[model samples]
Target: MQSTATSIKAYLEEIPEERKIAFTKLRETILENIPKGFVEQMSYGMIGYVVPHSIYPDGYHCEPKLPLPFMGIASQKNFIALYHMGIYANPELLNWFVTEYPKHSTQKLDMGKSCIRFKKMNQIPFELIAALVQKMSVQEWIICYESAFKK
Candidate 1:
């Protein structure tokens, strides 16, 4: 569910009580491992990590006013979702994540083009998520974003 909360703190507060711990840990994992240069903010009604306008003045191609989004996390209706643009734009990263998922969790990966759904909070692989977050830097993301989405 898209949250109407304007800040990350408020967003977290709005999530179901049972999910708060896991979701907060997931958020912490991303914050700790994400390479330098990405800024944390609320974007698309979720907790978003983005290359700010200071770094990428061109902004998101789809919406130039918005920063270039790198990753996002949200507590959805039935699951918590982690959205990584790197995995969607970089096949190598996607493959790596796919290959390593089984080693981390027994749960079959429930994923979309860029969104990884954690239906079981206990199964959310914080370590795997940490590794994934560190796989790309802001500069690398800008390059990948331009190549994959910019016309």
Candidate 2:
């Protein structure tokens, strides 16, 4: 069976008919707002945009196969998550997010690993999240990504 669709563009099209509109809007918001260097692709069954390892050749000392980029998005059973590696990667960013968005109680936000899970598109802060993505350097993002998978 096909686990994950190959490209982000195709994954969006594959969303169930009922959820297409919502997912598409979310996808558009992400595409329109993220920094220029980022590129979108389908990863783990959802739409993900990454900086690609090529941009940061010297990023991670180990786990060279994984890309050096810093962000991802996935469609889960209940919600679509906009995984911001930048927010979870930096302590300062994590603190700011928790303080600024107190209402995100049910959703999970982890600075140590940087992922924001939302049941719906409305639950996310588009501008702030976009800005966070904008702020991360490819190298900084790679450090964060490496930290998460490290044992």
Candidate 3:
């Protein structure tokens, strides 16, 4: 499949008809809550958001390379994946998620560095997810994301 960088508007347009509504709504909510300088794009065959290095310069290990992706969203084979930096990155928020979300379950989620997989959208506690996304800073997210994947 052909893939390229795109905006959220473009990414939403490309989602298959059956999944468009739900995914678009989710994308909107994320955009509404995430911090300024966060961007949406298609990466790894999914809709993803990134906090570019220009926005979080102190957090970058190298300039003009490896700008971090603090959060991401993906439509997978069976379910939609909301890859938050919170899963393994922020223990406090992750603990809350584990306890608060009704049908959510998490194991060793390490896809491109610490992604939590959710089978059903409703199973997520939207308020908490938004809160976590908003509360965690880009540097915090980078720390958590990298720590999770450390070898």
**Which candidate wins on TM-score?**
1
* lDDT (tens digit, per residue) of candidate 2 on 71-112: 676666666666676676577877777776655444455333
Model 1 alpha-carbon drift over 4 Å, by segment: none
Task: Please write out the lDDT profile of model 3 over residues 61-127, one tens digit for every residue.
Answer: 4433645666777766666667776665667877766665554323332233356555555444456
Model 2 pairs in collision: 88-114
Model 1 clashing residue pairs (backbone)? none
- Cα error of candidate 3 at position 116, Å: 3.7
Higher-scoring candidate on lDDT, 1 or 2? 1
Task: Give TM per candidate.
Answer: 0.99, 0.71, 0.69
Total clashing pairs for each candidate: 0, 1, 0
Please give, for residues 51-93, the per-residue lDDT of candidate 1 as tens digits. Answer: 9999999999999999999999999999999999999999999
What local lDDT score does residue 101 receive in model 2, on the 0 to 100 scale? Answer: 64
How does residue 110 of candidate 2 score in lDDT? 35
In candidate 3, residue 122 scores what lDDT?
Answer: 46
